[model samples]
Target: MSLFNVFDISGTAMSAQSVRLNTTASNLSNANSVSSSIDQTYRARHPVFAAEMNRATANMDDKASVGVKVLGVVESDKPLTVEYNPNHPMADKDGYIYKPNVNVMEEMANMISASRSYQTNIQIADSAKKMLSRTLRLGQ
Candidate 1:
């Protein structure tokens, strides 16, 4: 693969990680939100990613240079947590409050994993740039 391919791959990864971080933050922000009904509660969201293969180049079989693309964002289908809070203003007729299904622990873990992956991609891009620079000096 060409040295420039590294930048494309890493850039895609960084973009994907940014989406992940944003979703994680949104999930965490809504973790404590309460609603009177399940439909009104906020559900955790996550972005789906897919590998974008080069469809334009039929003869070029360079698979290593392909990058990732965000397929879409999906909300969690998990059931909302219901709690009995008669004193809460948003409590339903049965004195139940609906809370988001978001798991704080899982979201935190995802944030850490996404961050590490982003850092790794950055390091790979940096290393590739250093190698390319050294290669340019080889004839000197």
Candidate 2:
């Protein structure tokens, strides 16, 4: 793979991580939301990613770097939390309120992981830039 390909790989990775962070944020924001029924409750959303092969390098002898691509965001299939709150205004006829399936601790962990991955990609791009600059200086 060419040294320039590092930038493209890192850029794609950063973009994917940004989406992940955003989804995590959205899930956390709605963690406390209550609904009268399961259909009205929010489901935790997660970003799906897939590695895309570099077409340019596919036919070449050298292995090409794979870029990250976001497949899409999917809602968690886990069951939502059902709480009994007779006094709650939004409670159903059975005095049950529906809560989102989001786990606060899990979302926080996901946020930290996504942020760190994003930072790692930035560092990779910065390192590639420095390497390229040093290579140019060698001709001076």
By lDDT, the best candidate is 2
Error of 1 at 76 (Å): 0.4
- lDDT at position 125, candidate 2: 97
Kindly report which residue stretches of model 1 are placed more than 4 angstroms away from their true locations once superposed: 54-64
Per-residue CA lDDT of model 1 for 63-103, tens digit only, reads 46777899999999999999999999999999999999999
**C-alpha displacement of 35 in model 2, angstroms?**
0.4
Query: Which pairs of residues clash in candidate 2, taking residues 3 or more apart in a chain or in different chains?
Result: none
RMSD of each: 1.7, 1.6
Over 4 Å off in model 2, which ranges?
54-58, 61-63
User: What is candidate 2's lDDT per residue for 1-140, written digit by digit as tens?
Assistant: 77798998999999999999999999999999999999999999999998885554575666667899999999999999999999999999999999999999999999999999999999999999999999999999
TM-score of every model versus the real structure = 0.93, 0.94
